[model samples]
Target: MVETGRIRVAKDKADLVKSLISTDGATGPFQTFADAIAFAAALGAKHNRRVPLGEISKREPSPIRLEYFASMGHDCVIKLLAITETKDIKILSLTEESEAKRNLIFEEYANGGLEILQNELRGAVDYSERILLMLCPEREQQEQQNEEFDLSKFLS
Candidate 1:
């Protein structure tokens, strides 16, 4: 598995794109529909041992379009643009919303809301890292193979 020091939550599409590109083995800037999908799949495979192939396959086959999926936290959202064809599958872009929230929390901390700001900051870093790790291909593969991957043990 690819081990990066720490994953920072991406603040926008541009930042997310930059991080994905910065990963080892990513070639050139991913600027097209095909490039983004290929990169996401590769990144997913590298870190997570799995990719969200099932999620991609279940989408309606049609022209490319942006879609969003909600995650555990209200601030966490997965966004993607899917391109589907009879023989080819592609995702133009994929990003999460936690970075925006991270910024807000940072602002709050700066503004003297120490209590709430501290709590938010505590989880933001780890949450963002987990999001990135979850994108790893190895993780995705493992998830697809075992429906019963337990989290409780790890948590406890």
Candidate 2:
């Protein structure tokens, strides 16, 4: 029985970049959104709770995650977005992009599924029997569309 928290939405470029890092700066970088999800899971684990992807993604960008992504420049960020939108992006780094992007890439493409789930479960809220697994969903997920360039579309 896992208590899913909320999602963290990356508002701007900075926020999106921040979402790709681990809090402690001890690990290398998040290869996929699932790795980011694992980071969220790690965060929840550290606090003895389950943090929802929706909640984690929506969290405002803080200096805590490190503005390291900013230093990578727009070209790098574009590449990251492409990776984020990649279909079947793994929770772990299955590609060389991990080392190339400095580990700021994400895997899962969630279309803000939290609200949808909540709506379906509106009647009987039984979370105790549920176990949320962080996965690299086949679908594409993005917090918001970037005006600059979507790597997935561009590369395609």
Best candidate, lDDT: 2
- Give TM per candidate: 0.20, 0.22
**What does each candidate score in C-alpha RMSD?**
18.0, 17.1
* Candidate 1 whole-model C-alpha lDDT, 0 to 1: 0.30
Give per-candidate clash totals. Answer: 19, 22
Off by over 4 Å in 1: 1-12, 21-37, 41-84, 88-128, 135-156
Candidate 2: count of backbone clashes, pairs at least 3 residues apart or interchain: 22
Candidate 2: segments with Cα more than 4 A from true spot: 1-7, 10-84, 87-108, 130-156
